[model samples]
Target: MTDYSKELEIAKQAAQKGSEIIRNYTSNQNFNIELKGKNDLVTDADLETEKVILTHIRNVFPEDQIMAEESAGERRVPEARTWLVDPIDGTTNFAHGFPIYCVSVAMWEHGEPKVGVVLEVGRDQLFTAQKGRGARLNGSLIHISRITDPADSLIGTGFPYRDLHMVEHYLDLFEYLMHNTHGVRRPGSAAYDLCCVAAGYFDGFYEYSLNAWDVAAASLIIQEAGGEISDWEGDDNWLFGKRILAGNKVIHDFLLNAVEEHFTPEERKAEK
Candidate 1:
């Protein structure tokens, strides 16, 4: 097996640098926000942070490909050593000074994630993981919660901001989880929500319409932390599949079954 210690360090460094940029721009209310779609926002902070992260990565691994949120947009997952970056995952939260955003960075080689890092900017909690090494939060080893029952679990999720085609079915699933689980939260950032699952802060998480940069880093962290992640069909296509469900083994299965009961095959196929 190949060692990914150095790549893990690089991901942490890039995420930290990007977090600094996000913090610097947090106090300024006029960071030049624009809309890419009806409810999708892009800000100067997101663009500037992405540039800083990309530059730091390019300086160290100049030949590596990058798919950053503000610059490269979305692309097919390539076989080369590619870095997936989301400079600020929760642009809406940051733009409104809600302070629940993050800087996410991950490297993929041979079509799998090799290293991952996600830094929650508001609290400065850094999560890092390598292919084989266990996941970490601020340098301490972390693992998923052993909560087995959905009724006793706290679930995390995101609302559909850009795409509303599946809103009705999504809300049905949401209401079902609300009545079944201990509680449900929509934290705005999918990356941060997934990391919360990795750190055991959240027992599970699910959402739709998320892009590759949103989950690439956090999904690896979840797996390394002894958790499970997959699309609604329980497949390994969560990265680009537009839907994700994650949790510890038991809670994961519970969520999967809930999804199965709530969503239809036609709705699942619509996302693909």
Candidate 2:
């Protein structure tokens, strides 16, 4: 039997601690915040959360690699296992007190996501998943939405803020989805959005310019919940390919074809 109880326990513990820290700082009127990019913002909560979570993980598995959004450096050890963390996803939302952010913890073994936990701090909802086992939301089994028709599906997407240069192209894709799908919602938190997908709240989700921490845990949750994910090229480069498309099998295929029809591989390469 595949037992990931230890990994899940550590992830939940760290995530809970991070959530507590985030909640404590959310009400602070005067907190340190910085701009990491044009629209990217980082706050003291992020740093502190990552510190606590990292410290806890390192204490148990000192030699394992830990790669967090706030901290990039990793401990390169044998086994090539890495813990991916997003202390606070949807920082923009969190800073604005929009209650749309979450803490994500995931461990990738040999570059494959094996375990994941996304804690929606605001709502105290925990979405967890283990490879080949299944996905759960607050201990209840969850699955992706079965909406196959794009026009009848509630699709999720994120606008291009960091790389405005791709805004026009992204807008084109957005326009297509907006017109073709029932409707689109951009929750500003990719991690949380993936959980939404896993819970059948959203039928499909696509975005660009995302980091590993933002999608690592959520992606695995989606997969374990019987969803499909890939890049614009319909490949497995979602981690760093700067693009991601995820949905049920049929919707995933539809989205991939739509992307292929919008931009050719040559056009994409030219832009790069």
Candidate 3:
């Protein structure tokens, strides 16, 4: 197997660089924030941090493509060696002075995530993973939670902010989870939410209207940590498909079954 330690190192540095920018802006409270859409936010910190990350990657691997959330906007992930960067994964939380934001960086080779890193800026926690290597949190190996029953599971999720038309369907699922699960939390950052899954904090996570950059890095981390990730259809289309349900082995299957029963094909298509 090809070793991705070098790529993983680069990813960590890139994430740290982006995290520094996020911290600087957050501390100074000087970033210009704007709404990308309803309840969707972007900030100058996001743009500047993305530029810094893209430049850092180019300096080490100039031939690789880059898909940054701010710059790539509605573009498709290229079918090549590419760096996916989400400079600030929780802009709304960050802008509101909440400490749950993070910087996520991942390297993908031909649609496969090779290396992933997420820096939880507030607590200075680092989550890293390579394709074949096990996942880590601050250099210690981590694994997914073994909780199987929804009645005992603590789930994580993101609300459908961009499309209110899908709210009723989402709420239907949410209501079921609320009644069945131990509790549900929306942490405002999908990257961190997935990292929480990899670290075993959240037993599972499901959401719609997520983008490539939001889940790219964390998806690999989840897999390396011995979890599973897929779209609502329980397929590999989660990266670009906008709907994702992720968890450990048993919970993944449980969540997939729940997703299938609650969501319709028409709703999934409309998200795309």
**Residues 39-133 of candidate 2: C-alpha lDDT, one tens digit per residue:** 89999999999999999889998988888999786423125778999999999988888979999999988778889999998899999998888
Residue 185 of model 1: what lDDT? Answer: 92
Q: List the residue pairs that clash in candidate 2.
A: none
Whole-model lDDT values for every prediction: 0.91, 0.87, 0.89
RMSD of model 3 against the true structure: 1.4
Q: Model 3 off-target regions past 4 Å?
A: 269-272
Weakest 10 consecutive residues, lDDT, candidate 3? 263-272
| Clash-forming residue pairs, model 1 | none
Q: What shift in Å separates residue 167 of candidate 3 from its native position after superposition?
A: 0.5
Which of candidates 1 and 3 reaches a greater lDDT?
1
Supply the TM-score for candidate 1.
0.97
Residue 164 accuracy (lDDT) in model 2: 73
TM-score of each: 0.97, 0.94, 0.96
